[model samples]
Target: MVYDLAIIGGGPSGITAGIYAARQKMKTVLIAKSFGGQMAHKTVDIENYPGFDKISGLDLIEKFENQLKGKNVEILSEELHAIVKENDSFKISFEDGKFINATAVIIAAGAKPRKLDVEGESEFLGRGVSYCTTCDGPLYQGKDIVIAGGGNAGFESAIFMQNYANKVYILEYGPEARADEENQKRANENGKIELIVSADIKKIQGSAFMEKVVYADRVTGEEKEIKAQGVFVQIGYSPASHIVEHLADLNQRKEIIVNHDTMETRTPGLYAAGDITDGFLKQVVVAAADGAKASMSAYKYLQSKNG
Candidate 1:
């Protein structure tokens, strides 16, 4: 399909861009395998989003999606395989053998949650393991859940799960959690949240799903097993930039490097936003703002071409 703007992701950035482009009456298409990106997996309350003092990540993104209804933007549920510059326009190929031609492209694929490379992790994904607390937390409601990592995300997930689970255990491999002191204090004060520091997951044990978690102490080397119905992994995240790696300039961390003010990449017609771009705080509001900047820059680029 031929379009004025082709957005490569459906997360906050891509959707926000679609809202802007569609409102401007541009022929925009948003192709993504999934919407909401990393925030979908966070089954916690988001206290940072501007309007709502506290809301679920999924709930906020749902509102974002509702904003796009009836807009001129065409939403495609497909995974992007490759993107190539074709003359003055860009041609994007999807894994499903579909292609789109556009005058400008915005990449906002975002990042993937980091995984624990321990044994049995892959074998038990979805049986008793989960990365998204929002999607899987309700399944284990009123039961015990084990959460790995101690960052703000992890603590937030633990606090969110406390509403449903009998108890939430937070396993941090560091002496101190990476979360802000206030958040850590709140999580620690929650009677339902248990914090384990300087611990490393040794292995995930179960028959079909996760039944137990084996962890070792970093200092003493002592090992212990915690029986739980579910395990949520929130170690960190890696940028999702493989498809556009060869076409754009990427930083050492594999995120696309873009001009801070314009959100334009080294390539003239290409732009990047959100976690896939460097130098911005990774948050829903910032990502939405990035998308707006990228879309405006894309509009200018297209206008200059016609001029």
Candidate 2:
């Protein structure tokens, strides 16, 4: 049977859209390679999201799962490879050679962390190089750590690692820090976290486990190396929009272009939300709200077509 809506993700936004769509009595199915998406990658505490004072990433994902248990939404552990438009509906294709036809599609596949394309970076991924601070910080307790990036994510990683690490070095490629003022202040007050501006990470050097990070001073063009057992690349992220790249209108960053108010994409009956959308705010709460909006807008679109 053709589903009414298909949410192509398992993150907060897709889960929220599934819950909302199921609540509206629509035949909705949520598909993903796995549940929780990037929300399960890190072990950080989420305080900004409402309802909980502070929740671990794993615990929060479990909570999201619990809320979706009896929601009548069909959750599929399928890897969405591509989406093709067919007639007036859409066909969702999976890597496992499965297909599902839906009247409306909600593309909520979230973004992934941007990796530092430097030497020894990919080789020592599990050895010492990491992308999630909260996930790998505990392992490097009492050891010197290096964090790349100057945005809020970088500072947040520094804040979390400062308590356990002997030294925390933040490398920002710009002249000044771009993180929120409050976070920068906290990082500065600790004194354990050192902010290095105008710095560009050149390479990571080590044997089996990471030993030191090599960087270049952008201003003076001087090369320097720091003793760091652990290196966390907290640069930024890129949307997981490759599956629908040719089918939808995407911006320069490859983020799906959608209406901020409705989450409707350029193509009718196709909607997107969360980090995949062209929105500045990348918060869980905002994603959840966007998911709700997308589902509601899809429901209306269905009603109009049926009427």
Candidate 3:
């Protein structure tokens, strides 16, 4: 069946698009590998999303999911292998060799956390290593933990982890922390959070659970290991833009390039939103707003094409 709009993602961005498209009477179907995407895995406190003064990340995702329960949008739990333009429409291919066609496509596949790729990193995933600061930080209460990365994510993670962990140490490979001034200021003055600059993460070692984190000094060439029960890897994030790499123009970070005002890519009838696009911020509210904009743009494009 050919759909008027097919959204690729199940996160807040994708769901928001689906809701808006349904309200507009657009025949839309959503393909999501994991419902709620990575947001489902987050467990930390979220106080920014409107309405609730404070809530867990998972809880916020659940609330978003509930909003689409009675919507007219068709939701599918499947993996998308690729998206190819076919004249006026786009064809979506699944791993099982099935194809779905759509007049307009909105890509909101979300982003995945970058891994350290160090030894024992994968083996000790649930045991110690974690990517979601909100999901696993509370579990390591009263324990010493380390965070790798000096960006905003790292600093924010350090600030969050400090609430539960006895001591939080940020291991940054650069000479200084690159996080925002606010997070940096908070982390710098916090008694429980220590910033380790000019450090290179070498390996993660443990038997059943992570026992230590190893890093080298950039100039001294001396390696150091810290005793810790948990490690949060916050180097950066990689958007799920591989499927549309050829269909759209991607920046150096593999984020889809789109018009800021409309969220439309260089390719006509194709739009992108959320963490997958190179926008100002990667927040839930912003992504949902993008979803709304993309759907409106898609609706306008359809109207113009038919007229």
TM-score of decoy 3:
0.88
Q: Candidate 2's residue-wise lDDT over 141-165, tens digit each?
A: 8999999998988998899998789
Query: In model 2, which regions exceed 4 Å deviation?
Result: 52-54
lDDT of 1 at 299: 90
User: lDDT, candidate 2, residue 119?
Assistant: 93
TM-scores for all predictions: 0.92, 0.94, 0.88
**lDDT to native, each model:** 0.87, 0.90, 0.90
Encode model 1's per-residue lDDT on 138-164: one tens digit a residue. 888888889999998898788878888
lDDT at position 191, candidate 2: 85
Clashing pairs in 1: none
Candidate 1 TM-score, C-alpha based: 0.92
Q: Across residues 183-275, which tens digit of lDDT does each residue of candidate 3 receive?
A: 888886759998899998888888989999988999899999999999999998899999899889999999999998899999999999999
TM-score head-to-head 1 vs 2, winner: 2
Q: Comparing candidate 1 with candidate 3, which one achieves the higher TM-score?
A: 1
Number of clashing pairs per prediction, in order: 0, 0, 3
